[model samples]
Target chain A: MSTIARSPRRAAFFLSDRTGITVEMLGHSLLSQFENVPFDETTLPYLDTEEKAAAVVRKINERASADGLRPLVFSTFVNPQIRFVLDSANALHLDCFSIFIASMEAELGIRSSHAIGLSHRVGQPLDHGRRIEAIQFTLEHDDGLSQRNWQQADITLTGISRTGKTPTCLYLALQYGIYAANYPLIPEDFNRVELPAQFKKLRGKLFGFTIDPMRLHRIRSERKPDSEYASLKNCQYEVRQAETLMRREGIPYLDVTSKSIEELATAVLHQAKLERKIY
Target chain B: MSTIARSPRRAAFFLSDRTGITVEMLGHSLLSQFENVPFDETTLPYLDTEEKAAAVVRKINERASADGLRPLVFSTFVNPQIRFVLDSANALHLDCFSIFIASMEAELGIRSSHAIGLSHRVGQPLDHGRRIEAIQFTLEHDDGLSQRNWQQADITLTGISRTGKTPTCLYLALQYGIYAANYPLIPEDFNRVELPAQFKKLRGKLFGFTIDPMRLHRIRSERKPDSEYASLKNCQYEVRQAETLMRREGIPYLDVTSKSIEELATAVLHQAKLERKIY
Candidate 1:
């Protein structure tokens, strides 16, 4: 067997004028491609001022000196002055905005606003209000807590326990302003071939999640040790019965054994043909 | 006043081999800068195959032909063949990956893996497990449900109702693998000047949220209309008392009147100096 060599650790920074979530995510995407070089990542958010940019520059330069290599800096500052300040650092600065904004402006024949934090601003008060409303609605409808407004839900996810129904619903509500509700499918429902009575009229809005029995058993076992609910045979029976019921009812379902919450949410949106109310 | 002219609406597409969240967000950032140009945005994710890329090309071309203007296409496909298929569309293509990957590869003197869905994959099983655990812990600890593992929390948020404590805590747990717990400050807690006994020993882990009295009144009114709990007087009293308590107890706080959940979570992380356990 060949032994793997240890790679050098490099420092990477994700800097942005706002929350920096977008910048950090995009930077992580790029850095993940270079699997051999492990990155020590740090995110510096709300760097709208030149003073803050200068401070970040010192940090980057110090990291470069310590590593004996130039650090990689990914930034999304809209203000040119702040971008210039960050560019002064002794690192490979990847300006996420400047690289494309110039071309976009040329194509559109209009100047950019150069406003900081515009991406995450509460645009269209109605949309912002809807997002909050969706979150509240989602929380109220979690785990089939309240069917008071079941008809108002944009999508309803049904699954056995620990199939990632709650987190996926929350992500849909948080990110896209979708009024997502989740219902758990217990043994009682699994015993019947028909869809649950509450979901009969909402068939089109319903989606389902299934997981590998082995994975489900492991997940449940963690939550409750040595309980029949977490038994392997019980998990297998639940999953098989749930999938069979979903198929019999013609409900489209996804396997959540390996999907992330973001992936599950996006898949639900795509499969359910739901429009994103908020960006 | 000068007459405000209606701007032309342009079609913009965000294409990605995976969830398309990063591309959509970054594209939105750029599009938001061009305020005069209204963009009708659509995201086509999971375009890992050339057939899907060709289908997207047809749609983009159809949109361009109907609108009599080229649409803007922002993509992050890692495969060259799929990118080439998409480039055949009659649109203003803005390739997110190609723009920076070349420079990154050159800087590091290494070739990228060009792997699709690597950005959101469950890297390091331990990290992914920690994220799930954090989400479960946050959900269980919501609204001060349990103080059994209060010391294990990365951060605990305290605020009066309608101050956006729950959503912010969920965001922290969802995005950063942070074990965030939130406690609602009731009138009883407000009556006491000292910190709550549950939080007395966890001062450093505690962060507070305060909102404008008017805003809090409006938010609470929606839930409990015309009640003393939702009155402006009660809201003002709660705000005054909560802020006074936070100041007296030296607990750092933020005003969530205008901040988004993403912004609030990031601010908490920054102020608390909490390390992000997941990207």
Candidate 2:
């Protein structure tokens, strides 16, 4: 065997020319894929100048020297000056891992399920072209937009009692800054003939959140134990039919089963390709 | 104003022993604090061992040589060996700023918050204690922990329709691993003879979450327009009485007004001095 030894510790740097939090979150989750070796991370930010970037490399080099550390760095920013900073840094035993470096190779070589850029992936000009444009306009408006056109919401979520929707919508609003408006899909509206006209025309925006039949059954069972809605079979049927109708209409959705509101929102963003609006 | 020219660009590194995401968040917040010159940042990770730490320093030194990068390294980990590595790296850098170094004078002068290990300023005993201990057990056995003698929850959250208790409890469960069990404080419960006896005995474990009356009023106003329950006056009265009852019972509480769920949870943890269970 060659004399290449693998060290137990690996250092990673999530560097960015701007706010490095986004890159760090992505890197943290991606690194989570590896369960064995523990990951230690540090971030460097505002890497706008050659001198500042070089200083960052120096710190990395010194740390590596002390601990015999080899590090991976992931950086994203609009600036090109950061490259020189990493290039001139003590490259002896340091390894930089930038997504940009991978993106080129990924785009050229393999098939990627996910596309780059928030606008391209999320605001696809195909099926959701109109609503996406409308959303863009809504965001550009000055006065509080939600109060103006909430009834015209593309996607409306209705649920009896406490099926989480508002928090999820707020998360969507805050994260992607999407103009998300929530309508409580209540019991009265559940039996209504006309789905809101806006949602009818923009069915693509209409998504539903449902929990496991047993979990919902149990949840409602606690509130109104003897009610027919709390019965497992009835709960199961409502969920199944609702899901079937959504599927037949080609409306995408996710089961909010046993997931934290954050996890659910993250999954929704991932699946729905909702570019989380970074605040 | 002195003779030595001060460049507006300073080099900063937001370092962490483990996940750097929190550091990144802190860094962004800190940058927002500074109105003047923008600084640059670099990130590094996987620094649990001695060799890795040395390598990071060497890289820093090399970069310092090429550019006048006044490196500022903010890290949370404690390692005796880092001193030797940093000493060597300092030979190249004119100035350095490490939070650990700044904290050292205090450490040497004063007895540590803990007998051994880093001080409490790093938010030691990072756990929410027993409530979260129960939550972890429940999540690990999420299928049916309620079936067991899990009735004695530390604290219980109760609220009316859409008052944000389940999501908050789930957040506590996920973040602190607190076995937060919530029961709806329905109209019937509101009209009960007494508050739950479980809270009476375990008063320390009991806390309340209430939002501003106006917010509650607006939230209710949306769902059941023109209804007495949704009326601003009713919401205000109920909220006032709820606050009064909580105060009378000596339960600590928070106003979830215009705050994100994360902010609310953090405030609660801080108020409770709940040790963040660092995973």
Candidate 3:
């Protein structure tokens, strides 16, 4: 066995603005991308004040210089006052990273896609009356459940069975505290018009999800063993029909193939721009 | 809105060594302990060879020098040969972190009351079979039907309803590709002296999960309003009884109330000291 002992180095990160917990989580996920590196982490919240921002920068620069290290800053200082604070850090030649800076072009480039806007992604911003109405209709259509308890749902995921919908929905709810509710699209609804009547007037807020025909066919085949529902031909027809319906009706949708749970959820949220109800 | 062009600094972390993913996740979570700074991350697989270890260290040092930044390294290098390669990075003076270094003392510090030493931790000898058992069981339990397919199940989850058993089990199967089976622990099982006959004979490999009774009560109440199953009294009784059963049977278990899904899963794997099947 070989022994090597050295004092660990200190590389600091500073946040000049208060992006709140969202940026914190995003940063955390980003750091998880690196597991082989060791450095201490520190956060300075509520950097809206120039005094606080400057203080953070001063501390970071001091730490980096004293330890012969560099600091990485993840910030979103949209306010001009905050700009002065970061400008101070820049004078010190500190390294910084803002995801917005990297992703702005990518975000703008997405405009050309048949993209669904945010409000529709989060159920179309229904009025209280409409929300209650939609809930009642959902209850009536499905297991005859009551609406008194549905508001507690952080998010409701609605989709067809075997679409990997339930697992994904539950993942959102459990992992992110998004009370997602999923509704199955049954065989009878294949050609139905007006989108269950409840979803008609609320079309603006509706989000649709679809999967590859071949994959769905394989998934169904695993469940029933030998059934027409699992037939690739039927799956292709259904997928095409579903896509056509979504396009014609202007329902926003996502293709979940080849996406992990985190990526799919993040993409959906990014598309919906859902104001996270819980941290 | 004022426009302030502030670049957020990005930090990459790589955790290489035994069960590197756990260290990666923990390091990420620990960032939460610091509520101010934000990070961007990249995790590398375990360095099983000296060549890969050297290449990784070289690449990281190069990135650090090129970016004019020194990144943090959090790893658990087990193979002495790999450690030899990693040590060479000291020439660049990068901030290196090895969870193994912390874990060695932390493992020893685990309270005797806690069932420690049952699983392979950072510095423990590899127990590849237990991990394979967990993984195999998880795979067989895929998509929540493995309970019905018990014979094919390698690891089974038996718990009262809404204890988060299903989703957790599915995460193990889906994320880690482990086949995990889940069985409901009903009223009858609560009264039994022996585990399900299947598990009774396999007590050494069995695991029990318990959560805060109040949380369990709240969750169940949501599902079956005003029903006895959702009654706080029932939840308390079941949890107490389950604890007693586990203790009597010498079955290892975890209290999952305060833990996140990832934490709970890792804690269980850590407690069971199961070897990871993933390469």
Candidate 4:
């Protein structure tokens, strides 16, 4: 009879010479293939210098010591000096750039311009500029501050406070270059049977967000401790009232209590029929 | 005589039931594989409804007619009703979900969730909360507003005004849950020979951003037209002096004339040897 030990939980690191998003995304996509194995992740970006590489090595070694297994590192370190130091760490390194760069250099019969960069919407500078413009517009028009600019906005988000409003608006703006504005609903506004003055003219552009009262209570408690706003009873009252208002007003809404920001944002875009205006 | 038309500058669309980012990314990656072919793209996201789907079909038909070639659509539409409408369009439809989900269900012997969703990091509510906290922190610490929380930040960005400071910091916070902060360099700081007073205690966490004088002039002129601050001479002066100050201070900086916010944020993390602490 033979005794076998189960595979220990693994630690993974997304290490990059730059923002590390590309490597992280690529690593994540690949790791998702192994659906059965569980993993924990950390991202260490901007690993540009030898000293920094050494520090990362120490951290990796510490993790390896604690876990009794080597960690997996997906790295795009362009500089050879820093890459060499990182390679010395007690972990498995997946080098994304050097292998691909070499093959492309061979195939194209020209040296690659490896001036340390990330993989993104490449060769679309205009699209990227639009994204930045949308982000700026979203920031300027956030939280009912610039309701008059509804003509310029592609979508307007409305909800009671702390129902994942700002993050969704920012996500839509940054990811898709859609000019998004958000408005908060207060308790005083709940008394009215009709929509707000600004929203009266913005029915087609409006989208609402709602959350479970329990989650709202937890979020509010963290934001403001020991207040009427944070009480569970107040949370239930507010959510019930807000949902009723949205339904009566015929505004499309999403319940975000069980959803991440990405999921909430996705539902909003789908239900509101919002197109990405930038790319 | 036979004449070959110039491929009619083929058109492509990324269509989805949600945010369309996944389809866009996948379509772009596949399109990049065909280096010799040139194409124009439009993203039709949130096409979940019958009306929206019909509109997309019309747009696709119009593009095909205008381009004198059949358009290519990369779609992730989940609903059969919307998908049926989109499938009738005059284009080659590459249905992402149907092709993959069917095979996955067959292999796993289970029905896949058909909740129109985009790809993202999942099952990490803790990480999500961290991202929100980092965003709040970054907002509070923007433009040197709250220097008292320097200890809480993983990185601090310094640059001349409008040199892509706030956006990059916010991007880092939102995307990677990195507690990032930014400080603006005014004319007064240009005269100094060393780093600013607040950054004196933050050597390891400091990074810098720079932009080309012409680009800076263009950006500023649009922000404040016909002002001395937007003058080419003033922009050139400030950029030169700012670069010198950063160099003298031994702070690494990048020129942001051509890079997107994504690129800039990535570069800052790589060059600064910064790690995202939130996740």
Per-candidate DockQ vs. reference: 0.52, 0.02, 0.03, 0.15
Worst 10 residues of 3 chain B by lDDT: B117-126
Task: List lDDT for all candidates, in order.
Answer: 0.87, 0.50, 0.50, 0.74
- Would you list the rank order by DockQ, best first? 1, 4, 3, 2
**Pairs clashing within candidate 1:** none
What docking grade does candidate 4 earn?
A: incorrect
Candidate 3 lDDT, tens digit per residue, A207-249?
5678878777766785677788889888887777777777877
Interface RMSD (one decimal) of model 2: 15.4
How well docked is model 3, in DockQ terms? 0.03
Against the true structure, candidate 1 reaches a TM-score of 0.94
TM-scores for all predictions: 0.94, 0.37, 0.48, 0.71
lDDT of 4 by residue, A188-244 (tens): 889987776778888788888888898889888998999999999999999999889
Clashes (N, CA, C under 3 Å) per candidate:
0, 62, 61, 4
- Write the residue-wise lDDT of candidate 1 on A1-279 in tens digits: 656544448989999988888889999999999888888888999998899899999989988887778999999989999999988999999999998898888888899999876775644322347777888899999999998989999999998998988888888988899999999999999767676678898888899999989988888888898899999999999999998889989889988877887888888888788999876
lDDT of 2 by residue, A147-259 (tens): 45554443444333334555455445434445555544444444556555554665655566766788778667866888987998878777776666556556666677645
User: What range of 10 consecutive residues in model 3 chain A has the weakest lDDT sum?
Assistant: A111-120
Model 4 C-alpha lDDT per residue in residues B1-279, reported as the tens digit of each score: 557665666687888876566666655544554455566877777677999899888989998887777787877676767888888988877765564445434433456445543234453432347877887888789899987778788888888877888778877887777889888888888877666666888777888888888888888887799999999999999988888988888888888887777777777766776765532
Query: lDDT: which is higher, 1 or 4?
Result: 1
